[model samples]
Target: MQANSLDDLAAGLARNRIAGLVADLRLDGLHSKAEAAAVQTAALDAYADDFAGYVLVGTSELSRRGLGLSSPIFAPLADRALFGDGWRIHLPQGMIGAQCELAFTLGRAYPERGESIDRHSAADAILACQPAIGLLGRRVRPGTESELAAIADFALHVATVCGPLVEPADKDSLDRAVMTARIDGKTVVTAKAGTILGHPLEALVWLAQKLARHNRQLNAGDVVTIGSCAPILQVLPGQHLTVEFEMIGTASCWFD
Candidate 1:
């Protein structure tokens, strides 16, 4: 029963039909980390087994859903899972937490074909990096350290958007740059890009290597969010949100 349930979860992810279902499940209750991991592994296996065209998207689907998994999942996977810098778990009813960070995309096929990515090469082949925001549903509590569980569950990652890429910056110097967000021209949250794992670039590099263990790699054009440097703030419907970076530029979105 356990294995079959795991396979079913994986198959759902492979089909990309699990998003709404996951959203539904998370809203209703939470699952154990082992169960969530089984779901993620199944999804990855199904993704590799069936949909080869969207390997990167299929692989990250777990990360996308995992964001919403309960805290039980995070406790076990924290040590084993490679965490992307930024991720958000949405709470029930529309309270949102926005996680902003830098992400990576691989220009070369990493960890090779037919095999999952390994930690070392996964960390090495970061071709391009971009600034991004991860929208978290504030109503949900997916637990702590469950990056793998969250990835397996889709990270509860609702949407991910990226700005233009800049050359990698040194860790110590990156923090001084200012980052600000305004909702309807009103400031919501502001901080330095270094809020994530200290230096956002290192987080990206770290994520690449971490994802390798599950046979995943950062692909060219794959959008990765390193971590949030700023605190997750409240957002609402019919509101327009904008963010600007001293060097990286700006992006905005409206909530319905």
Candidate 2:
């Protein structure tokens, strides 16, 4: 599936066996975000039945045409790196960044295929919650200017390190939760929770609806994560990155 250019992705798509691409398409001339999104959708649509669900692709942006759309770029489960604390995650490309987010794993089926969900119902389906730190890497070379360009590169999601699970009712109120990130004993970024679309559960709802647009449903055992309150902090080789959630717990990973 490795190719010299984005055109090569088509050959990979033609196989029709790709659960999905950990794509980082750097094709030129896609001026509008809508067009870029279409490209992402096309990749997903190429393997409609064999789809493994797109991970890490969620954004609500008002287009120039006055439409709010889902930019459908994502990686398959193979790209996920679920790890425990004090684990060494290799950033093969020698470049990586970190974001702290509240992540959830559903215990039971939700929005069951033809069904829709709301924040209240979405929360009901959750099995547990945890502090998660998402890892990001660039694939559109190293000098991409636009955030959207970097996003079109599916390699954005490298791994997600999760903390100990917590029952929904037993977890601390997200609104009062504060977060901090430290690398090698030095603090790098800090943030307050409840700001990713106002709350952690709200982001899950947003994710559910976003997937619904593609005729995709949130199945049981799915992991949905939201945006980070802290700035994307860069990580270096041999450094330790830890994201902590007060009253909940912490998730940490080392880079090599």
Candidate 3:
């Protein structure tokens, strides 16, 4: 049993020290509720360090601990790269998604439980805007519903790409705003900002609140990828993809 709490673990991870510990757990293939709590705590602490925390745990982690395993592997957390303001990962097999959505550059440290800030309050805090991607990969050889193994395998976060700057607006009719992704000049996926969470700003709100729970806040100059607007698009080597949004702007990438 770990004497430390989830908050402690979160802080450790936020500081990048948890990587070694996470590696050790992965090597041992141990999974226990105590360990999971410790990891979550470490994650929360890590978020506190950066002032940007993750409130949600992937579903796989929850189920594994429920089954009483020791040291289950963890998903490659996205916050790590986000905290560094720069990092890259190779996309895993069966993991390809080209999403179009608004990317938020915050204006201030989004408070967790203080006076809640409205959508307009968020608009003024914008630093830069670029289309963003979450880069998700599934567990290798996914099990049938409950027989899932580990989330550590799914920890391969490809990349998070954001552009320079774009205009910030109230964005009430985000769903009406159309965004598209093109590959090699061919349209691949098209959707609206509303696809993110009814409204793009909602993603901002979700991000703000979620971060707060982990004792982290989105401060000014943090780039927040709201979520995906389109379905995952498989890519091949040398594929050129361009994503265009409504009021936000555009970003491009080349797959090797």
Instruction: Give me the candidate number with maximum lDDT.
Output: 2
What would the per-residue lDDT of candidate 2 be over residues 170-236, giving only the tens digit for each residue?
Answer: 4336756888888887888777776555666666667677667777666677766665656667788
lDDT of 3 at 206: 61
List ranges where model 3 is wrong by over 4 Å. 1-96, 138-141, 144-156
Error of 1 at 161 (Å): 1.8
Question: What's the candidate order when arranged by decreasing lDDT?
Answer: 2, 3, 1
Q: How do the predictions measure up, each by TM-score?
A: 0.61, 0.73, 0.62
Task: Write one digit per residue (lDDT tens) for candidate 3, span 10-87.
Answer: 453333332322221221222553454455444444443442322211222222243332322223234444422122
The TM-score between candidate 1 and the true structure equals 0.61
Give Cα-based local distance difference scores for all models. 0.48, 0.58, 0.48
Instruction: Flag regions of model 1 displaced more than 4 Å.
Output: 7-34, 41-95, 109-127, 138-152, 167-172, 214-216
Candidate 2 overall Cα lDDT vs. reference?
A: 0.58
What lDDT score goes with residue 176 in model 1? 66
Q: Model 2 off-target regions past 4 Å?
A: 1-7, 10-25, 31-80, 94-96, 113-116, 143-148, 170-172
